[model samples]
Target chain A: GDSVTQTEGLVTLTEGLPVMLNCTYQSTYSPFLFWYVQHLNEAPKLLLKSFTDNKRPEHQGFHATLHKSSSSFHLQKSSAQLSDSALYYCALSGEGSNAKLTFGKGTKLSVKS
Target chain B: NAGVIQTPRHKVTGKGQEATLWCEPISGHSAVFWYRQTIVQGLEFLTYFRNQAPIDDSGMPKERFSAQMPNQSHSTLKIQSTQPQDSAVYLCASSRGHERLFFGHGTKLSVL
Candidate 1:
């Protein structure tokens, strides 16, 4: 079985402040981690994905390093913006083409001015 | 590309009624996935099809829920005797070679 845990239900931050949303996962097989972002009234979209080569994945000024030892791939941004408000989901997929994703209960990020 | 397409952005059904949701995967994608989103359950995997074949559906309710992928382009999810508790936004996603998935707008199913 595979599972993802995002401890933060909500994260509030002011503009220009650093932000981090915690994500950890458990899996029976080698894991493929992903970050999906959903804005108000919009479908969720891929924010970033882990590379097997160990290169930290980044998108839109947000980055995450997948640490297999810790089972963590925390999302981080150096400077939060007002538009960063959204729901963030951490997902895990096992190896192989038929693998299905297991997602974490999302973290709602609210960036204020 | 148009991405994944899910028909009928919203659906309303009475309890005990049947509802069928449709999904069109992106062209050239080999995988199609279905997920349900709710306030309480968050996001849940229902089923998926790879290469136009059913791969796994362990998350689907065995009694009333069923899914099919008769072709590579389209798939369907049907719920018989829909319950109020079954209400949620049904999302469809497609991926190529198991890479990044692209999700559709989703059909919000409201079982009243």
Candidate 2:
């Protein structure tokens, strides 16, 4: 079975500060990792996904690198925006197509001004 | 596209009552998935359908939960004799044979 571990509980930061939400995984097969973000009262949407070619996936001022040796894909942003306040989930899936994504417990990021 | 659409943004039901949640996946999508979100468990996979057939339901409750995708457009999750512990946000997602899942706003189920 595959599982993902993310930063526990809440992560509060002042606006413009660096953001890093730790995420690690254990998978039986080759892993395909993903990040999903859910704002208050909004559905969770895909933030970024790990590339097989090792390109760091970036979106909306956020990026994550898949470190296979470390089993980590920590989400990072050089400057956190107030709009980054939301719940962030780290998910894992098998290399097979349509494999179910196993999600972490999630980290609530609250960026204040 | 409207993405995934889940009906009855919120649902209230009494204990022992039945609840059915509706989901309309994005057109041309071959996969539809159901998940339950709670503060305690975060996001838990319930079941998934691929090409209108159930692929896996390992996370669904054995007794009260059932899901069906009768057609390509819509699927339903029915909970019989709902319990208070069943209260959570039920989300529906669809994918176009790819891993990127587009989720719906979800239906908040409150069982009392």
TM-score chain B for all models. Answer: 0.97, 0.98
Instruction: Give the interface RMSD values of the models in order.
Output: 1.2, 1.2
lDDT string for model 1 (B42-92, tens) is 789999988988888989999999999998989999999999999999999
Enumerate the candidates' DockQ scores in order: 0.77, 0.74
DockQ versus reference, model 2: 0.74
The sequence of per-residue lDDT tens digits that candidate 1 reaches over residues A25-95 is 99877788999999998989999999999999889999999999999999999999999999999999855
Kindly list the per-residue Cα lDDT of model 2 for residues A9-95, writing each as its tens digit: 799999999999999999877788999999999999999999999999999999999999999999999999999999999999855
As a whole number from 0 to 100, the lDDT of residue B73 in candidate 1 is 85
**Residue A3 displacement (Å), model 1:** 0.6
Which pairs clash in model 1?
none
